[model samples]
Target: MRYEKIKTLSELKNIIKGLRAKNKRIVFTNGCFELLHAGHASYLQKARAMGDILVVGLNSDSSVRKIKGGPRPVTKEKDRAKVLSLLWCVDFITIFSSTTPFNLLKAVRPDVLVKGGDWKVKDIVGSDLVTSYGGKVKSLPYLKGYSTTGLIKKINLLTPRRCAVRTYAAGKKGNTL
Candidate 1:
């Protein structure tokens, strides 16, 4: 499936309204999605099941760095978006630099909002927005041991941490990270 891109608020708002008119239910999901994993695929697939179209709000590179800290976002935003775009479940992709997807949510006002079960419904950023618009929010259970953080951490384990191995104080004899 081809991926539609949402660049500006106006375009997103129009897209939602247009799709809605065609009796299409849109499902909205947002996250850093730093490193795609089984959990991500499962969550996305479930989100897709909730609506006729799945619009994913991906964090911009800077936003990912800000939320995840430096050395994060193993993949660049473009590459990440491209990867998701190729997925059969994702119909549209929007890259946002905001910490929360509030603005994007308000603009899209999707028929359904989906997130992993780890987050409480009330804790979700756009839950209220969707609810206000008579939309629904659903959470899908995550796959065990499948997470972007866990994936990155596992990769980190394979690659040793860089260190200077400096002598601590003069008499210290233990090496530490």
Candidate 2:
């Protein structure tokens, strides 16, 4: 019933400080999370398994559009954060407007930083920062054939025709129904 997991940068800083004092292993991961799919759920669960708490850096709507181009982030930032807050694996969620989570990661100073295998270790934002602080960095593989782009394509294919055709390829009349 509580949605306190979604916090602002300042609030998260305080929370992280307390968690660290308690010696909780914090794991951090960030993404646009445009569409909450099974792949995301699975990835978060696996990331959480590597530590005691999982903190997600949610990309803001404008950031998503800048990074992912137009027609992105079908869901709003607050909505995405709200949905992520529902996941048991997600201990905290913070909306960041930056294209990369470097600043947020610096603030979190998590015990672990994780990204999908699709990203190379050198390319992962904040990988070096985590490692510099003696934290672990991991690239977990994404679920096969479970991506937002693919889902959108499948949905487009299933959409019914808006206009009716009265003829077939052989010049034969066909029923609109």
lDDT of each: 0.83, 0.90
Give candidates' CA RMSD values in order: 7.9, 6.6
**Model 2 collision count:** 0
lDDT of 1 by residue, 74-98 (tens): 8999888888887899988888989
If scored against the real structure, what TM-score would every candidate get?
0.83, 0.88
The numbered model that scores best in TM-score is 2
| True lDDT of residue 12, candidate 1 | 69
Which number leads on lDDT? 2
Q: How accurate is candidate 1 locally (lDDT)?
A: 0.83
Output the TM-score of candidate 1: 0.83
Cα RMSD for candidate 1? 7.9
Worst 10 residues of 2 by lDDT: 159-168
Error of 1 at 36 (Å): 1.2
